[model samples]
Target: MNTNEEHEPRIEVTAPLGERYDEMLSAGALGFLADLHDRFASRRHDLLAERMRRRVEIANGRDPQFMPETAWIRQDLTWRVAGAAPGLEDRRVEITGPTDRKMSINALNSGARVWLADQEDATSPTWANVVEGQLSLHDAICGILSFTSAEGKEYRVTAERTPTIVMRPRGWHLAEKHLHFVDRQGRSLPASGSLVDFGLYFWHNAQRLVDAGRGPYFYLPKIESHEEARLWNDVFVFAQQRIGMPRGTVRATVLIETLPAAFQMEEILYQLREHCAGLNAGRWDYLFSIIKTYRSRGSEYVLPDRTQLTMTTPFMRAYTELLVATCHRRGAYAIGGMSAFIPNRRDPEVTERAFAKVTDDKRREAGDGFDGTWVAHPDLIPIAQAEFDAVLGERPNQLERTRDDMHVTASDLLAFKGAGGEVTLAGVRDDIAVTLRYVESWLRGVGAAAIDNLMEDAATAEIARSQLWQWIENETVTAEGERIDVELVHRLRDEVLGQLPRTASDRFDDAVKVLEQVALRPEYPAFLTVMAYTRYLGETPTTESTTQPETPAQPKSAREHARLVGERDELPIAV
Candidate 1:
């Protein structure tokens, strides 16, 4: 070698991974990984692909899972109850009376599937007493799990969230071996952007549930985007790989409240196709946000009646429509959001009016296409379920109605009304799809058996392209202005100064009766009041870390079904 005198030039190498690059890496070609492979053994190399295999499951903004089931059979709720189990931890409000505390062991025993004991930011009690109460809760859950149906058959019962008790690995193993993996956790989990990896706590815990014999159910909170849902899927995949829960044993319900999420509804629905139980209305934050959303515009839209402001507005309509479509498209249950803070006892008049309102909501929601709705109070259970029962039995047939509505076609015609069939740049329209979405929602409650115009399979969103052969058709729905407007006649009738003979159900007859109840000026003084109450729950807030989820670790189909059947048998409970 000629050294410096007559030397060959030496080349310097730098890695693309910057300072973190390894000397073992040989090439500068890789963005990062390539260089490592050159120095490392080929045996360690593998492609990083998505865990679910590269099958893209969504199509034209819909999940394949949301289709109507061809086979029809009614499912009974036996070992379960379907209403909110009041916050055992809800210190802001108390359910205690001379006869009962807001939530009771009897209610837990009354076939509720989820008894959400209060754990976060509620109550007033000593940590020790709360811990003791949790121990009691654990015992109660154990008892419930051991409970049998009226037929005296043991339905491998699984209890939920007794107290946030930590399980020694062995106790966890034993409990899981006995009952289902439990639904033992609840919290706001208030992360701003997204939730932690579903796999972070998901896989380890799900394996525990799978081992213990329970299906997995989780309530994911603080969700703000569709990517949050993807994260859930990723977690599920990892959990499945570790614990062997089937692709869908685990289920989750996202609380819909954050404003950004309202527009991302489709993506959120698609992202959690297999796992979603549907969305719920988180009222407190939503109303608070409404104030913020309208602060700049002022409160011109504010309603005098709070009830009138129910999630039943235009935005609610759009949000629910997308939700129903997404759920129906994916063959999942499209649940209606909450009607919260209603008084919980069953007063006949209150129940009747509540029933009517709920029916109307269910009907309207059904018209918009929702499968179920939430009733916040224990007392509202009967009314809510009865309303839903009317619709559940008819889904298979009404699904056909949805298909037919999809057939209404469109074509170019005069943008404005004119002589018949004059072709213009204006496009014809049929809102049957929009209307049928509402009809389908009503059908989901009753389990009715009827079939009409139900074969809804179609290949295109363009109404004309779908049935292009119809190349020419034009129609407009009857606008309200087109309806009859009859005025009182000054002319004498056939009988001379007489009106049509009245029947008991006649409109004029009913109006006359209503007029008798009020003076002509009609001032009985009916005005709604908005009030706030600072109620105290009898428990103190302790760091939730002291409490841990007590879910079953194993999942068994038979037991789960039996448990659900028992759940269905009980009247829906309210708190």
Candidate 2:
């Protein structure tokens, strides 16, 4: 808790951030200035301890390992919306699934990347596949890292080679992923808590690559909190010690999706900011929380439609801003979120339009700006990379922008506007600092957060704190005094007023119709964009959530795998 004697945030400072400052400096000298600006962080006399603590955390968050700058939204990694259909039409969908040959090839093709193989969510398959009753996560991940499509030209793209398999965060618990039902015998489940295989998993994986003289990396999944992040750090430390793969070499990219974790973004980032290679905006899980956390009280929060709500919403903008800020602040590459679907079959318009929309979003994000965006479909991958390349468009990678905002001064910090756009510069920059840290933590793919933070009940307090303030301060909004149902009102304003813009290039009424069916229904509540996220997962990823999730299915046999690849469907790539 941070407070003054009267419980207000202290506003005075003891010393400046630098050793000495009697001279003037230019904006070009700001990078060196941030280094010097940091010394003053310890002089928080007027600030609350909590705020100052966070400030210090931000100050000390200068590390080569942190990945606040890059963007990688995990849910978009797959094209399927929980195995329903391709959200859009596209060429070559890459189906990233487990050993289960039961997965639909047709569905897998929904996106370009068929990221077959599982480590985090597919633990059931990992454990079940243990021959002699012993399965290793390393082996399991290795087993399905890459896939050969229906066309025989086996795409060599994969996170193979344990050293190449980076795990920024290694401590992962299954229950954190909401695989609710545990063993009937009621034994401690793997998901419920960090399991033993975790350390061994990384150690074995890292060792595999070290012996082969390569770097190891991973895509950490389902992270819910910071302790989980620290736990992962611990695992990496252990793996580094045991595997002899250079003590600080264990690397990973994490996913940010669940509810509580999203709010605690800064704290999570502070905990593991240095270890991230990239950050992801776990779109689907985040949307699931938006409604699931809210409407479970017998009511629902209906967002506008996907096309209308996703790319253009205030929250999404804020999220993208944070991602961009994190990347810039940390000197890491900023990535963008996914566009949800990929074209399953070739229809130039479907893919062309989808790619165009994705390109637009990515371009906008890059403009605002981001480093890269994701595509679940292989075709989309090239498109995403192309968009990024185009935006970066021949600009030589200027080492000039590297970490210039470090030693932030009173003046520099004072210039930021915060989410309200009304904050003093310092506050805005501080907020950017915090948000960036969290985004970096999210990008350490393959790691998992804890179970507690992945809440079923939503916390509206943050909405009250962040959104309400943001709404009130916005220069564009014109509403009467604090409306009774603030959340309801703001939501309605967007719903009623923010009808899709034509430039959105999506069917407004149809998108609304698609969302409303799930929203207005008495079946279940609708929050952020869970339906959209689930739609994305089912469409690209092999698995779909059902009333009852059953066993891990078998994989394609050698002959079947060969056959699936031998016959190339000379179909068009997109609509």
Candidate 3:
């Protein structure tokens, strides 16, 4: 336990402190995180509640439109976000991965202009991972991060020009249960994961990074509204002031990944103008958000196979073009989404096809006026960079190429007609298998996995399971005229399980159970990870008593607590 100011609350560490964890979780850092929670946690809660309320409105047939109230902000064409921070001015290629020590070093040395060290969808939030990720960033900044594989392959940061580091913290809806803070009324609350990640990173490395000619940059993820973007802007302001740094030192790139956010791209950038660097077309999660937002509307909004929904699709094109037009109009870079293809050295045909697809995707983004794009693995960085290079020969970015001809409307954004592909029994089986495998891996503290040569993360699983749920709910008829139903899904699941090797039977079975609980329910869970977290990662505190003590008894250790809870009986499968 660490105490802050006499009037301020103290933070209790319920997780076992590991090597270097103490260095990152010092008293001052904890105090800073606590301050952020005390000030903004409630607002975060309210914003999430508003998300649910807005979902209800959409369910009642209120199609999302650009806000009339924010028309003044959108119409003000003279305003622009702050110019790019040091080392961020030329982000023609950026690589993304978790901030494990090895990954931190490799990404920094990946030759891309920026490395998106992720703590969100690409990371599984085990307690160790959360704390160690912060430590990895700290070390990477100090130029001491390295790794050695089992075969004695030593990896280090050898790039003469390393990528600028931009951290992506967790979203607002999640809480850092490992860290506890007391509120004014003597009620204990979980610290916002967003604050814990941002506060610790900024507190320890802001000055260091600034002195190194780069500052503490970020990628704000899973935001739904300009108000949410405003919340982050305020956070950056307070954190900079709290640490005695300049107000604009913390730069952020917002991911316009939600359906509502697609409509408010300009508004989001406007809200974070002073701190905004750019916006990313977070394409995968954007797809999941579309399905989740319109799940109840009817069959018209239901999406097709995730494989079929390319960036060139009408709705997707509308979203990307609108993003580029909005961003470049405001003097901010419009980054394209991730190209989740990992090269296979042993299979030249697979590698060649993947490279061709990556080349086409990057070429499309570059030609469409995007400043840069994301690559999952280092091997694909050169492929993406070459395309961007050909388009942007001398210029660092295409911010000047504002696509004014892109006249996207609400209908264009929501146009899913002709995009649906054949949904077969094989598709159903694949979805079940991928969703189950992903959930199982997520529970075991792995967030990014390569399944069938595609890098599948939380967003991929979200799309997989959400498609199944949407198809079943709509009784969507497949290409063979087989309508999706609970019985059909079950048959597919069983058939997939039967084909699995005996060694993986138990794990696959548990995954099936989890998929049923989340995807097959009468109502869709907002996030599959949230449900999986409660069931496997950490236990939720009791909501029965209102007048209880501010801080509950501490758990012996986070690992032990997780073990006990994970052993609890699994949720019963829906019949």
Candidate 4:
């Protein structure tokens, strides 16, 4: 490990370094990260504690309404966020993917206006991925990224029309255990994943990006409140000042994913006004947050199957419409949610139907005045762009179309009562199937899975598992009059495991164990990835030694893997 002899606070990397890892983790970068930790880590802790306190209040029937204290911020309409920084003006379509080498090239060349190079939901936080993803982003920024497949097909970033690169760091809830920082008490604490990602990226490439006519743009994920937005804004300020750049050089677009965040869109944008780009309607995580927040409220709050919860539902409509109006009112862009459909290569009919659905989804967003939309796959890019183009035409955006007709009350946002379609046996099976498969892929170091022609990520798994827990907790009866109890879930789980394809049996078995533990428990875990990280992926500090065990004495389930790591600690009891 390399360290600066003169710096007081040094970054001690517990993870093994890989090729080019040193370049990204230099003393200067690590020192910047440590400085961020020292300045803001305690505030991050307090904010997380605030999140828990709020959740408890909600559990005690304290409904979330617009904060009366921040009423003036919302009522006042003269303020607007800073205008778009370089390379962020015309974001009609943005493609999102992990920052692996090939994906970096494909997404940048995908013809979308912006590429959300994701280190968050779309990436498994393996140590190698954490380090290598930064390397990929750096290479892409310098226009030196290229890849040759094992079959010898070369891929490179096209020189013509490359999309603007906007990095999405991990959320504030997570910690980077691989990077340790010593506190004043001489004790070690995990570095904030958010800081590590943002600090490293900013330290390495902020100037280069600015020199290349783009600023260091980001997509802030999983923020629950405006204070969280304030934390990010403060980080942006410190980072720019530390690196000797302008104050608003770092622009960020916050993802309105959590239900609480949906209610505070204006406040969030207000807090980050100088550094804000806009807001994104993160459809899947938003649903997961709703279910998680209100799971104990009985059937009125119980969501139906994951498949039935479309964006057109009354509650979802209220959320999105309010977001568009809020953004336009504040003079910011309103970006739509992801269309997760991946075209089926073999079946033209399936591809056509999927494209049609995507077209409708994007058209609705365009007509409702969204400046842009998100697509997971390259093929869907043109489909989404065409819809946005039909609405945008020669204009860069439709910020002039202020959606004054929309007014979303708290009750309308909470009107999930019977809005989603009825739960059914097929939905139960699908929930189990998709959750298991997704968890399996995640264990194998893949975060995004193309399951059944849809791009399923961590959010998809969260919604699926949350649905199971909600159903079982509420004793929700399926359309066939079968109660979704623990027994039925276990039965379906075993049956699904039995039906798994031969090649995937071992991984599928591991996935079933994970799904059962998370979904069938008496209390719902806040996030499955958090627990799974402490279990399977936390074995080794780095990816070099942490690849799956070659020969195991027992079945390599996530639980077994945890045991292999000598971690026998009981799962934390949910509050």
Candidate 5:
């Protein structure tokens, strides 16, 4: 054990460093991460434990309600978040994508007001990805980032006015397996992915962003409680103080995606009052959260197919309406959800239809008084911007709209029947195909994939597997009158696998294993990513080790998808 009583503990690089990793993993950066882990890792663990407790309570028929203790935070209408920071104002349209070199440049050149450079759902946290993403952001801020394709095409930031960059780190529930932190007592544990992503970005770019007339901005994800919000606020305060930036220089927009988070929007905002810039309607993950939270309650809590759960669904409508109302009343930006319609170049008709659907979605959001919305492709930027432009001809935002007419209750938010659609054979097949494709792509280092002309991420895969589990547990009857059982799911899974093309690099075999472990297993895993990461992507332990990785209770999934095929029919159904 490398005990250090006189100084801060060390952060050991467990995996072999890749090209230019030295630049990202300098002694100073490691020291900063060590300090962060030493201070807050225990608290993060406790909060995650609290999340599981909440899940168990909900599973046993305890419905979540707005807390009476936090009532003062909601009723005290005098408090408001800090006004929008310099580059965050007038966010009529924002583009979201992974932080690769080409995508980063394209997003910067795209005619949107902000770029959500995502490191969470859209990124697979391979060591190369982790370091290279930080490098891309650093180089972009310094105005020198560029990429040259193998075919000799050069990509650079060509826009005269680029979008304001806001990075989304991994959620608190994840651990960075490649790096281990040694605490003062000579104990080693995996570093928190949240801190590694945030600490690296903030440590490198805080001053550079300030020099360019912007501060470090972020999109906080998977925050379930106001207490989690307070934790992030404290992180921001500590980060800024350490870097000598003024207080509140770091602004964050919390994603109200989880079910528990919906009831505490007001309290969440109050906790991050000094650093809050807005709240986002993370539609896909919100749906997944609903199923994950209440999967065991009963059939009423079971959701319909993912295709049927649209933003216009009654419960979804209530969620978004309440989000806008809460944000505007508190002087924060109400950003709408992403329209995951990617244009198909080979089929102009497909592209045209995609444009039409995106237009209607953005139009509804604009008319509902959202300050802005998100787009996955650059071609949709003009469509989204045009809608917001029609709504606000000369204003930067609709902050004054104040959607006071909205009134939502707990029952309204939990109106699952409102998402009405049958669990048809088509829906089940779609879920299986999508999970296989998305997980395969993830294993091969692509986090965001174009499936059926839509941009799909980890959230999409989570929804697919979660719905499958929920349907099986409830013995859901399909529209075709076939009951969902282990045998039927196995046949569909094999059929989907047979249809997908097999390339030398495709991980379809592993993807199948992942689906079964997460969806077909008797016990529910809280997160499929954890199971996948630990089984396949965790560090290989190539270096000297003082301690083993701490294993948190994780959701089960396949690695190459071949592990549990023969035994599928033997797994018992849980009701």
Candidate 6:
């Protein structure tokens, strides 16, 4: 524990302390978290408020476009991000998975170039998961991470080549209710999940990573605007300084998942240029954001089946094109989205089709000048790598081909009419079934699950539920001429639930309640996980209250953050 911890905000652990939890929730680590919250909590509040304000503007019929105020940053092409840090330069095949022990070993032993240690959408933040996930990373870095099944089978990282690890923390909007922080004025607040995840990972491993010839690298998720990006940059600066590391020792790749972010890609990159490595195409979450943002507008924003809106769709194509162009122009890496096709070992035909689809997706990305792409299963790594190798033989990346020839506009991005497909009864049923199964699994403390031979996480659930709500709001009619309404959704929900197994331990009933609340309600919840977290997982408090609340408590301002500048200040950072 740090000797100076008494002066920091006091951290209270609300959950039952399990085995080895103390190692992660040490006094020094909690002190680091408290300092982070003290410095950035107010700005986080301001940014979230800005997000709500922007959403209201969009709902008032103002379409998102390139901002007029930040044109100078976009017009200036001379600035480049502090390009790829050590162990991150030659990333051609990246595998993304939750940070479970077995999955972590499999991912590291896989021949992928990088492993995205996902703690965000790919992880359900049960108390055990939140603590043990940190333990997994700590052990993995120490080269002792392993797992043993009940049947005596063991899994370990023994491959000749291991992938570099890049951690993805939870987004800014989520709160970690298992932990709380008391400010100097004695106001208790829910801990910011982003701060706790990033602070623990960085505090425990920053020096160790530097010793291993790598730095603390990260993938930032769910950023909606450049101002949020600026907040991240500020946090990175403060964190490195707090750890006594160099100003630019940390590297981050922002996930351009939201629709507003796509319009400000250049500005997002420019804000984090000192620590930015690249931008990733979070395809599923991008679709979810589109539905959530424009769900109230009209039929034009109402999409077809989720299967119909593939990466080749016009709007998706525009998003990716602009991403690659902006990244290459600014000397940053352009990574592709995940292909969530999990292979079936028992069926040869199923595996063959999975390989073909993944190959086609990777082939398109490689042909379009992407630096790398993501795969869910290790079995598909070689397939993705082969496609990228065919395009980039002996070359680390195709950074030289800037692709300045391709130009995309806001109209191209909002071209929902180009995705012409009729919504079908089968599509609605599939969404219902998938959402139910995934939500049940999530409530059971599993974030990543194989459903219908595809690896799915919270992003998939978000898309599914948002589509249901949007279809109901727009009174969408299926190809069979059946109007999608509350009755239809409720009936289909029952039908899907009837088909699912009802074991004694199943949480299907709770899942149904969640589905009804998020999908069948008049007001769309910003995130389904927030509702589930508060209602199910966030019942415990330091004062011994076990009763669940219907909604999450709003964050309160603690104090003002003082801007810190070092010897390497080129621009003033907004705090």
Candidate 5 structure quality by residue, lDDT tens digits, 270-371: 999999999999999999999887776668777878888889999999999999999999999999999778899899998999999999999999999899
Ranking by TM-score: 5, 6, 4, 3, 2, 1
lDDT of 6 at 515: 88
| Model 1 Cα lDDT, one tens digit per residue, 1-575 | 32235222111222132221232222321112221212221111111011011111111112222122311111211211121112211111111100012233434432322333322101112222222333333334334323344687553323343221111110000000001111112111111011111222232244444444443445454344565556655555545654555776666656555444554554665677666655544443343333222211212322222223455454445455555554444444455654433432335565556556656755665455555554434455555555555665543212222221321111111001111222121111211221122122211211111112111111011121111101111111122222111111111111211333545533332222222211111111010000000011112212324422233443353223222221111111110
Candidate 2 overall lDDT versus native: 0.34
Clashing residue pairs, backbone N/CA/C < 3 A, model 6: none
Where is model 5 more than 4 Å wrong at Cα?
A: 1-7, 538-575
State the displacement of the C-alpha of residue 509, model 5, in Å, after optimal TM-score superposition: 1.0
Off by over 4 Å in 2: 1-201, 211-213, 296-301, 393-575
TM-score: the better of candidates 2 and 4:
4
Clashes of 3: 0
Clash count list over all predictions: 92, 117, 0, 0, 7, 0
Write down the worst ten-residue block by lDDT for model 3.
566-575
lDDT of 6 by residue, 211-295 (tens): 9988899999999999999999999999999878999989999999999999999999999999999999999999999988888
- List the pairs of residues colliding in candidate 5: 509-560, 510-560, 510-561, 513-558, 513-561, 514-558, 525-555
Please state the error at residue 531 of candidate 2 in Å. Answer: 17
lDDT per residue for candidate 2 within 1-575, as digits (tens), equals: 22222221111111232221211112222222222112221221112122223322332332112223422322122211110011111112122322223222222333332232333332221222211111222433345423355775453323321112222221232111111112222222112212322333343455555454434544555565555565556555545654355555644445666544554444454455545444456565555444333322111122322223454455555554554454444433444555555554546666566667667765665556554454444456666656556656655222224343433222221221221222232232222222222212212221111111211111121121222223222311322323223344335434432532344433333333322323222222122112322222211322224411122233243222212221111111111
Error of 1 at 263 (Å): 1.0
Candidate 1 segments whose C-alpha is farther than 4 A from its true place: 1-107, 110-214, 238-248, 281-285, 297-305, 341-353, 394-575
Candidate 4 lDDT over residue span 484-556, tens digit each? 9989998998888788775833467667767866788653457888767756665452332352224446544
Residue 117 in model 4: lDDT: 94
Where model 3 places Cα greater than 4 Å from the true spot, the runs are: 1-7, 150-152, 502-507, 538-575
Candidate 5 local lDDT, residue 490:
94
Summed over model 6, clashes come to 0
As a whole number from 0 to 100, the lDDT of residue 27 in candidate 2 is: 28
Give candidate 4's whole-model lDDT. 0.85
